[model samples]
Target chain A: MSIGSTIICLLGALFMTSSAFGQAMDAPTDLAGTGYFRDQDTLPGSFRFYQQLPGGESGFWGMGPSRPNLRRSSFKIDAHDDVVYYSPEVRCQKCHEPQTKDLHYLRMGITCVQCHRGQPVAGVYQYYSPLNPIRRHAYVCAKCHEGATPSFASYMVHEPNPIASEAQGRFPLLYYAVWFMLILAGGVFVIFLPYTVFWWIRDLVAKLTRRPSHGS
Target chain B: MAVDRTRLKRFPPVQRLWHLGLLVVFMILSVTGIAWMYFETPWGRGLAEQFGGFTGTLEIHRIAGLVMLAGFVLHLLYMLFKIDWKRFSQSLMGPDSLVFQWIDIKGFFAHLGWVFGLRKYPHFDRWSWWEKFDYWAVWWGLIIVGVTGLMLYNPVLTSDFMPGWLLNVALWVHRIEAVLAMGHIFTIHFTVEHWRPSAFPYNASMFDGSVDLEEARHEHPAWVERLEREGRLEGTLVPPPPVPLRILYFVFGYAIILLGLFLLVFAIANAALLTLF
Candidate 1:
């Protein structure tokens, strides 16, 4: 992309997408790098990003129902009972229904030409390998889900503090302090717990069983 | 009904006020801190929504944490100035002082023996070994939480002096210490401090700043005996609190304890459900 195009993209993103924490979202102008996205699987066990955008109905016996529409555009699973996950089906024109047909990156459906640019293809259908395999898929999906052509949500909104999820190599002070705290708490709980529980029960039993002999 | 209607001082106004402050701040910190730490959970998400959102909850946690640390500093200052320099040495090693003595070590075993019915009710002074332990636990907890909290609060500044990884260390330490505090305070403190039958329902002494004379004698026979020997028992006595003041103490104590118990139970149940399923 040219410098002029980059500037145009950034400027366009500023107006198009804003975050809850107030920052201009980066428009994902380069779609191929985002990652491979297959909209729907053909069969039951064949699912990746989503299982299948099941037909609009109450669904089969044990499976969850498909969504009525994408107006809400939410992503969730029943967690406890859902047998299979599904997504709303996406036909080309269902997404590309805008008047400005050329650059409807915000509300448009994806096509082969969008990311493949000039790459050769042998068949009508072939799974494209993710250009940036290292990036999290959640982030790649967030480009469209959270933003129009861009994703403006701060990293804080997207993920936890980077240092927190991964281990910080070796810190003795941390281990020592954690151990000290654990030992202190553990010692109190382990050593005195029997006596503590015993006394509590004793007090409770004494209260329940014994009558107050003194006059009121 | 004829009530003895005699009272003795247990905590002063400053200490009582500090206790109230700690209660409020600790409650806020625990709720806000856990919401973020356990954000992935349903309860965590539910609480985060109550405080507006995750960021809002985080801000509240930070502010309340700073307030707690400030209260801690003020308390230390109060302790220093509250004491008389003329008797500084005595205060350090004094029987009345919160400082641990050889007797506390012995008292620990004696308490165990008494609990098991192997010994007579162990002798106790103004502060029992467990009481001192409770007091000092909070003291050390603040230091750990405060230091690590500050480091996490400003990772950039902390990372300048120390490695970046210390923040992770700080995170776990802060979390473990805090959870332990919640567990200890909710279970053990509630059990021993106010739930004891003699002090059952609610201990008005903490709020009204005086234990009934019977209370003092029951829990602190050695202290009461010392007062009697020094001819100070009569001077230390006061009339019972008014019925309305007693009612207020009951309300206040129950509110805090009930909230604490609810939180403890909720956390345990939530963890159990998450783990089992």
Candidate 2:
């Protein structure tokens, strides 16, 4: 590429990376939706407004406070005494359903832990989030936290390697590496080798037929 | 006074043989090595498969790696013992020379300017910065590629001590380095040696063991001047010594051509198969 193109691409890349960081930080930390949070009394599906459900509960569709503040409700339910995990083994996939209904759901840029909080599978507090929310126990959290030696970020923070899926044979790196290299080598050689061979033959014919030009 | 042919200051017989040997070995190794790396390409994977499997590429790659290592050692010995060490050092690594100096950055730009008629031709001496860069790049590449290549081939040995993630990093570095080396060879090296206007056909100094006096003066003026100063000047327009290299050239050339053809056929077949996928 020309110097101008290189500089333009570099500046563009820098701008994109900076804007990505900006968008990440701009994400709302509070679970409450914007307009609905204007008044606490009119919190979606609260007791004061609609208390005529099958179970005499105010929430619609029996979805316990399907409002975004369910996360806040969970926090309020257990204030002083924090919920914990106490499982022999703990893994992120246990709660996160390794495959979502939509392929793009995971690819939608939503952080998994943002909604599925606590010790992944074996950790449920009050407010009853999922139908079968696993209760929090100390042992489950200890798998990744509270170690003498600091564990990896995957353990402590749950940051996954971006290329993890590709590395795990989901995408065939070896297949590409082997085939691409061979094909490229062959294709390129095929393109040029004929000229080289012809040149060599031409040189040979010149040598046999006449006094050589002795071109170096 | 006319000089006897035997007393002429040509490269030593062993040096010439060593150069030729390395040239052949390195060429094969480079070809096979590169072929393996591009295994996803039509030729690369097919060649690897023909060798038996993925392990075949590794085995051949290791063989080439050994040959290259031997070449490197022999080169060092030739540098230290066979050649005039002072001349070699001055030519190959001397810092005070413009060829090895930072101003070669200017030479590069100046050459580009000459390409567009903004400046005169770059009057380089002994070695251009590009040549020096090529030399240094080879050494750097050998170390980086050689070490990583060994580690990758023998995972059992590596896994004994090193972390798993380190292997990943090494693979990344080795692959990228190969790409860089290939690019430099095909483009910069090709242009410098053969694609230049004067040297359009080819430069046979490496094969013929003597450069044309005019070429010596033009391309490497310092060496020519040094020879004159030392009263070691050969004839300005003497024809090259009869090398009898055509037979050798035909043999090596045809071998490469045949191998290249085989690779081409294999690659085409591989592409057809991949299309079915």
Highest lDDT among the candidates is held by which one?
A: 1
| CAPRI-style quality class for the chain A–B interface of candidate 1 | incorrect
Total clashing pairs for each candidate: 3, 34
Model 1 scores a C-alpha lDDT of: 0.61
Candidate 1 per-residue lDDT over residues B84-154, each given as its tens digit: 79989788778688989999999889777766657656678889998888888898889988988987775
Candidates in order have lDDT scores of 0.61, 0.48
A87-184 in candidate 1: lDDT tens per residue?
22433345334312221232133553343222331111123322112132233434444321211111111111222312111223434555677787
Candidate 2 is scored at a TM of 0.49
lDDT accuracy of residue A121 in candidate 1? 18
Q: What is the TM-score of chain A in candidate 1?
A: 0.20
Residue pairs with backbone atoms closer than 3 Å in model 1 (clashes)? A25-A152, A27-A150, A53-A87
Q: Which candidate gets the maximum DockQ versus the true structure?
A: 1
